[model samples]
Target: MTSLMALVVGVLYAAAIYMMLRRSIVKLVIGLVLLSNAANLLIFTAAGLRRDAPPLVPDDAQVPAGLVADPLAQALILTAIVIGFGVLAFAVVLIRRAYEVVEADDMHQMRDTDT
Candidate 1:
């Protein structure tokens, strides 16, 4: 499962880079979203996959009875997801404003307008 997830992450990263290299601003946003997702998956995979219970312990026990999921990875992924959403939202707004100002979605055209 870890290997599979690693492969998936690799594919997502590759796709993200490909999309980011495109000339369209929309594609760049899509690439950013993909890149964020890949990072989250990488963190998850690094944390290890296990058929374990939640990271909880009985009142009398000093530790969990058996294998337990890593809470830190979950927290990190959750934080990353929220941050990614905010970044995506900001990018969308920025793109919209840029389009309004330059009347172009192509990065090349927008750059040309600077002259």
Candidate 2:
């Protein structure tokens, strides 16, 4: 399972990087989202998926060994997800504004407009 997840993460990351190099603003934004998901998945994997132990603990029960989920990684992933969302939202708005102001969606159109 881990190997499969790692492969998926690698493919997603590669695709994101490739898409980010495109001249279009939309593709770049999509690439960023993909990259963010890949990073989050990688972090989750790093925390170790222990099935034997439940993450939740009772008020009076002592925490069992190897049973606690790494809340730190979860928190970090949450933060990353929020930041990614903010960046993605900003990029979308910027792209929309650019489209309205420039009257074109393609990068080539904008470049040609300067001539």
Candidate 3:
């Protein structure tokens, strides 16, 4: 499972990089979103995975009887997801406003105005 997740993260990163290099503003924003997802997956894989185990302790027990999933990774991923969404939203809005003013979504065309 870890290996599979690692592969997925690698693929996501590759796709993100490919998209990021494009000249389109929409592709850049998509790449940013994919980058965040890849980061989250990497964090999750690094934290490890467990099966049939819950991160909980029973009553009258000092600690969990068996292996319990780590909660820190879950919490971190949750926080990251929320932050990523906000960033993506802002980026989209900024791109929209820029498109309105510049009348172009292509970075090359937008840069032509500098002359």
Quote each prediction's TM-score. Answer: 0.92, 0.81, 0.92
How much is 34 displaced in model 3, in angstroms?
0.5
Off by over 4 Å in 2: 62-66, 109-115
lDDT of 1 by residue, 39-110 (tens): 999999998999889999999999989889999999999999999999899999999998888888889987
lDDT of 2 by residue, 13-77 (tens): 99999988888878978898899999999998877765555567677778755556678788999
What is the clash tally of candidate 1?
0
Which scores greater on TM-score, model 1 or model 2?
Answer: 1
Worst 10 residues of 1 by lDDT: 106-115
Clashing residue pairs in candidate 2, if any? none
Error of 3 at 21 (Å): 0.5
lDDT of 1: 0.93
The global C-alpha lDDT for each of the candidates, from Candidate 1 onward, is: 0.93, 0.84, 0.92
Residue 98 miss distance in model 2 (angstroms): 1.2
| lDDT of each residue in 1-115, candidate 3, tens digit only | 9999999999999999999999999999999999999999999999987784887888989898888899899999999999999989999999999999889888987876588
Report the Cα lDDT for residue 47, model 3: 92
